[model samples]
Target chain A: MATEVLQQDAQAPARAATLYHIENPEVENKAERFLNAFAAVLHFTDYKALLDSYCASSAKCGRCVASCQVYQVSRDPRDIPCYRSNLLLDVYRRHFTVGGWLKAHIGGGWSLTDALVDEMADIFYRCTACRRCTLECPLGIDHGLITRLGRYILSMAGIAPKALQVSVREQLEGETRNTSKLPEPALVDTLEFLAEEMAESLGVKLEFPLDQPDRDYGFFCAVSDYLMEPDTLMGNAAVLYAAGDWDRWTIGSRNFDAINYGLFYSDWHLERIIKRLVGEAKRLRAGTLLIGECGHASRSACQFVPVFAGQDELPVKSFIEYTLECIEDERIHLDPDIVTEKVTYHDPCNIARSGWIVEQPRRILRSFVKDFVEMTPHGRTNYCCGGGGGLVSMDETHEWRMKVAGRVKAEQIRATEAEIVVAPCANCKKQLKELVDYHELPCRVMGLHDLVLRAIDIPGGKSARQRQDEAALAATA
Target chain B: MEHWLELARGPLFAFTFLVMGLGLARHVLLQVHGLVTRKGQRLRQAPWRRIASSTLSWAVPVGHLDRSTLVMTTASFLFHIGAVVVPVFLAAHVALWSGFLGVSLPALGEGAADLLTALTIVCVLVLVAYRLMTPRARALTRASDYGVLGLVLVPFLSGFLAAHPTLNPLPWSWMMLLHILSAELLLLAIPFTKLAHVVLFPFDRLSEVHWQLRPGAGDRVAAALYGEEAHV
Candidate 1:
């Protein structure tokens, strides 16, 4: 029987809907007042000086574009960061120039009005804030940083979409990271159901240790995988367990979700999510923090957590690195016969483009798949699936999301005729699936962990029952 | 002749008075509008020395001014010297201002003023050429750069030609009028372009240097950038 594990929550609580909204009147009012005051005093000198001193110097080189997946896929002129940033650049010129002032008095400031704010809001949100552009830019002018600041500007003007605002608020208040806010009790029930389903399917009893004390490793996975990406989540567990390292690892019941809200709007929100994960790790007494196959989550662990929360000495490892390390240490062994199809690896932006991580995922992929074809623009320069920067959870921007964000990614996948696409990040997985489906591309999306699980050999070789079953299955065939 | 001087006094007073008045108005408009579009909120007091140095350093070049703002300040210093010297030295402009203000300073001879006019022409050309050539300036340079240059150049060039008075009566008067008109255009452009940076640069530089000399400035820059909460 073909077996499939569906979306399951570990335990959900019965409580008020965790969907948050922009409710702080004080913050909102202050933000609005500041923006209005700022607009009134803007001048050409201050504007140009700012560009020359800070922005121009950093964004001077074009190396950061090498990290964008969208540019890799579509090869479109407008998809690049420089072109997109120029849209904002035009507005600055028209309002601040002497000729601009003269033109405005003659009614030429029409473009500087509210309508342009809406367009800016749309364009900035389309970016995933993955920091891929920073890798290519010579001065390290982080495109992600600028994009976040732009989002803040748009939000203050009331030009931001309600869905994103709501999601950001919810995540800020410690709600579930995913759109579907399944509470604690509900998540617990779902985990129980998955335990039974896994037992029946594989004929092996599996124990998912939650809140286990003195665990050496802190196991963190994306909220999306626990709900929507089942194969990837279970495959992660299976790989760990088969290597007999599962006994040393434990998942926390209270804060198992590793989704970083910093990927969305506010620095405050990013800090909130990372702090929760860190607190959980400390509670479990885990020495090493094992990050699952999520790009931004690992980045938050490796980069933002230390910076924002003042945690410097934590051992953070991505799943790819963890898997590779285990393989190198001779802990986890694989049988390559299981995966017969040709595969091409799609490098998630955070892991491939960001400086902290690289190489491990490709090495792991090489081990399992017989033939791994590289995409036209692979690694750091890969395209965003349009689901980054919290757009996947944002419901209102779905149409624009599909049209503008995934347009390049859809083209990139179509160019590659490979049968399977392996993306590590959960959000990337969702974005890729929808983009592929929308474009009517013929390819199956699989996580790197899922491939590893299939190729990983069970402990002590094949059992007597497995040998008998293979013979019996051969006779039937 | 006294009656003629009185008649010209109203025009001179109106033009100079308006130029001085509108300069303040431009500053007010920029401050109010700039605050409206700004996103972040920071309350900072202006630093005195930085302001003084930047004001003093206005003589430095736009590209590099290692203690001496090199090329920019050099050309600008010449430009200002010409502006001050030519008008005070020129027999015609001094005569006009004296008609209104009832005051007179030592006047240069026609030969000396004419030589000063030629020097002013050279400085204006150098400034315009520099704006066009430098890449940093090129990226920032707009049509206004040329327009402002034209405003100053037209008046100076016409005055130079009109001084000889070889042209017919009507053309001579017309050229003089065109020269005055371009000067007015330049005065209007001064508060608007990156030329406005002339006024803003002093305040910005003062604040930057002031902050740099303060205790723990290095730690603050890193902490602010890295999201560390520690106060430097």
Candidate 2:
């Protein structure tokens, strides 16, 4: 009777919340081959050893379950951090442990079936790899690590989310220079258009320096910002102009996008993306690589650049850090009276938990915003924006992401009652925007630099009347 | 019963300690070897002071456990303290340790040890109830969870019965032997079960910090596997 149940469960297609449709046999075969090859690799041997060490002693305290955003909303036993990790641990034990070895021989141990693989793929991807759970765990069992490791294994099998894989592949091998598939000509035209818009609206001339060699910094941002977040770009350009560091920074012509989807899916992709960033920096001989307000991008570059690029000779600084430094030095003055709306900042999980970039954004916000409020559990303890772990790009998972994973973040924002919520990370902004609409909350999501743009006092620019006239003229054209 | 008590106190006791010592040492050695031989990206400099402070803070129930799970945290803390203190400070255990190590440690008074043992038993019972009743805990709980609880309860119950001989249905010698045998089993199970956290907690926390704060040989390994240049 138990065997029948097991067989039925194994044969049933997983109906759990998943971003990928897994009915294709060709894809399944590819995934199986990839897993087998990955399993065979000696490079992963140390990982296996490490996984075995921590997993065996898991206390299953459920402290991690309370910390997880997904588990908090779904209340699903499968969503529990330890339980999710146990899926992989079970596979490891069944194949590796002496007791499990005997059980296998006696036909009593669990086997890795296709349904198990599908289920594993589904649940592992549900985790955002936020590492908040690590903070609460007594043993500090990093379920985030387990999640990523599981994803990496799944990715090898070609069992990853289609959106992430497509973006990563395009960035690495597509005709376009970046993941947005924007050709260089289109990129140039977009920049020229943005500069004109900035000049007309912000009354400042924004020059996107292309392929300038030996600049002090090479700026990279999410490619989507070019089209989706023109104001954020305008704000960034305005700050640079006001700070008089315009000449020191250049956006690379070949590699303007800093967004690394590889950070979400696989080490192979992560390595490829990191290498491109490094190669671009070296090619330009830029002293520093300035990552724009994208959380995972900032973390990926800061944390993995040294490892992947082989040297931290070129430092990686987040645009938030740069803005804060300008504020601290009084390089750019802000009019505190410019905006009176109550504002709060959302700390992106990658920035706060993984990269320790919590205070810099708050410091920036405190300088200009007269009424700054903090979310109840702000900073490292803050929930994910629901679009984390590349969910923002996975359109299939948007409903689940909004309803389950992003629900806590929505509640946090609602509690703040701040008219404007400043989220520096692009992914967070996307999720928070949708969350604002979905939750029907009276709130607006803006970038940190968007707020900076509103308050910045750009000298020798057009007057309000003249800027309004130019904007009207541009709109007419 | 006398023969069983004598065997538990002598050869069985020695054998359990030997197995425990060897098992724990092997476990520690394996972890150390993995750390030493770990390839790829070099870890970022660890904030030693912060790590120490964080470890100390987590040792108690103050901030580490969430507000929702405070009851379980309190039970866990009490159970751990009682579990360690009752066994080590009991007069008979102290005498055994003194005999084995040639160093005499202070022993708890019989009344105090009995009170602690009883309180500890209650704490374990509370924890077991928490596991059974809480939906999340029940989901996570396995046979090993109940097995570990039983392993802990047997020794404490037996020790309490042996100390207050009037309460036990079994002979005094039999109760004493059961106490020793159960304790031996617990020690033998330590390196192989969830109880390995006794030896692994500090190291696990450190490993987490290393992974989070620093980069490791990811690039080097990738370069070796794929190539020095970007695949594109």
Candidate 3:
């Protein structure tokens, strides 16, 4: 008789039922539904090769154990990266491989079941998909990619976190065609308001151009920024004005939202979101897609755009890169003495984990900030703010994100003791802001653009104090 | 018992070696199939120098260490070194390979082989103890993990003892037979198990280079799930 090792833990505590909701009714049981999803995911994705290679080679060396923040906090057996990966890999081995088939026939192996599906639903969501563990694995087993694969398959079964599912559905199929369901008029009004605010505060008229054709750049920001990060949008407006002429960049009224929740869960949703950005870029007649301070959204376009478009139809450049270019080309001069508060940057995992977009932001920061501090392990291998992988959107998992997932990150930030944490990615900013508040750290989180806005030498723009000081100096002379 | 020992050393040894060799080849071929051009997917040209350098870095893995990983990574580096060195270069083992295949490989001297064998045993012990003691390692370990390590250590322990009978507690024939059987079991198991990382390591290290985002796939999957009107 086969011994069922995990069948006992099949009843393992899972918030999956609340988290996962499926509309499909054809499947007989949850196991069958999940297996069907696995087949579908396999059919749709080129992941069989990755799965086969990883299954054969992963040593489960526990080198990743120390790297995983979740494992460190929970100490749960399920949180181990390799062990969690095996939860899905075990199914593939048993069902897809010859040895596993033989073992199953001889009554000596485990199989995918309803309990295991529930367990995966619970555990897969807990991971932030930061890919820090991938950097640590000497064998190059991408545990973060495995988490994504698992999440992708689960999403197929309709067993995904409701927060992500809802947002994706809205972004792909809703009335406004964005995650937050913000209307085009509302976006227009917000940009107008931001421009008016910049004009009032800086004593110069700044343009927030929208739906303008034949522009050099089409800007896409995490839609949530319009609602919550107006300061960041204001900064982007000022910097773009200083960097390029008014006719150069425009925000598409239709596709200004850059946050792709699909990246966190479903590929179908991720691709759909990218397709909209491509369309938006074309609508603006853009030479490039300018992504704002959103981590996963930038990665979705930077990496996936080439994959989906089959050619680099529109070059994707992060706003950080664009700003650095402005600085390099002498188009914009950031006043280094302007920012006196000790400021440090948090590298969002999506942009930096692969060593892309890591250095440009630092160059931009060091150019302007008077007191710049670097986090202990800042670039590429930086810790997730616990709200990554779309946990930031879900109110239900907030406690878990704060207490367990965000713990290490909180410690990292506190150690920096910097007054300002400039998170270039919108997701990191949201998570880090909440993280500091939760941990009661003195640090405040802002988008990199938010800090740069204060220092940017906007054309003909100077504060009243600057004008007053100049007048006083002239009088004294 | 002597006849069994001879068979274990000759045809059975050849069979197990062939199995491992063929299985590893298949793994390499499958990985190549995955890594190379796929029909529906678009493959990006990965930066060749970076990949080469990155794969080399893992071999020595001197970078990417901190307080958290320094001790464990050091043990792993030592363990991998001994794991490869002792099995391939042991003087007694090279003779068998040379006679069977007519391909003579370099051999480690008696003192070197013994020292490496002892090192491998100690590293394996430290690793095993980690699994048994640490909750995370225990969680990560399956039964096969222990089985594989135990399989690897048996030959080193028994062969080391058989060579030095003064230190050997078991009878000579039993030690030789046990060593041969355990070695054969390990060889048969390697191709079919995680020990195949020995060959698959390079493939895993370079997996990122070829990862693609196939166009139309998302639509294909979505339509399949939610029908023709599935995707927006």
Q: Write the per-residue lDDT of candidate 2 for residues B1-232, one digit (tens) a residue.
A: 7888888888888999899888878778877766656632343444457567768877675776567888888888888889889778888889988987687889999788888899999998988998889888887888889999999999999888878868998988878878899999998998889888787776676654334321333444445445566342
Candidate 2 chain A TM is 0.92
Q: Higher TM-score: candidate 1 or 2?
A: 2
Q: 2 or 3: which has the higher DockQ?
A: 3
TM-score ranking from best to worst? 3, 2, 1
DockQ of predicted candidate 2: 0.44
lDDT winner between candidates 1 and 2: 2
TM-score, one value per model: 0.58, 0.92, 0.93
Clashes of each: 53, 7, 1
TM-score of model 3 relative to the true fold?
Answer: 0.93
Q: What's model 1's lDDT at A458?
A: 54
* Ranking according to lDDT, highest score first: 3, 2, 1
Question: Model 3, range B1-232, lDDT digits (tens) per residue?
Answer: 8898899998999889999899999999987886565533344445557567767777778886677667667777888888788778888878977898888999999898888888888888888888788777777777888988898889889988988899999999989999988888988988888999888888787657634555677778767767788643
Candidate whose DockQ is highest = 3
Tens digits of per-residue lDDT for model 2, A14-49: 655456553243565543544464454325435654
Candidate 3 chain A, poorest ten consecutive residues by summed lDDT: A16-25
True contacts kept of each: 0.00, 0.39, 0.67
Worst 10 residues of 2 chain B by lDDT: B209-218
Error of 3 at A216 (Å): 1.4
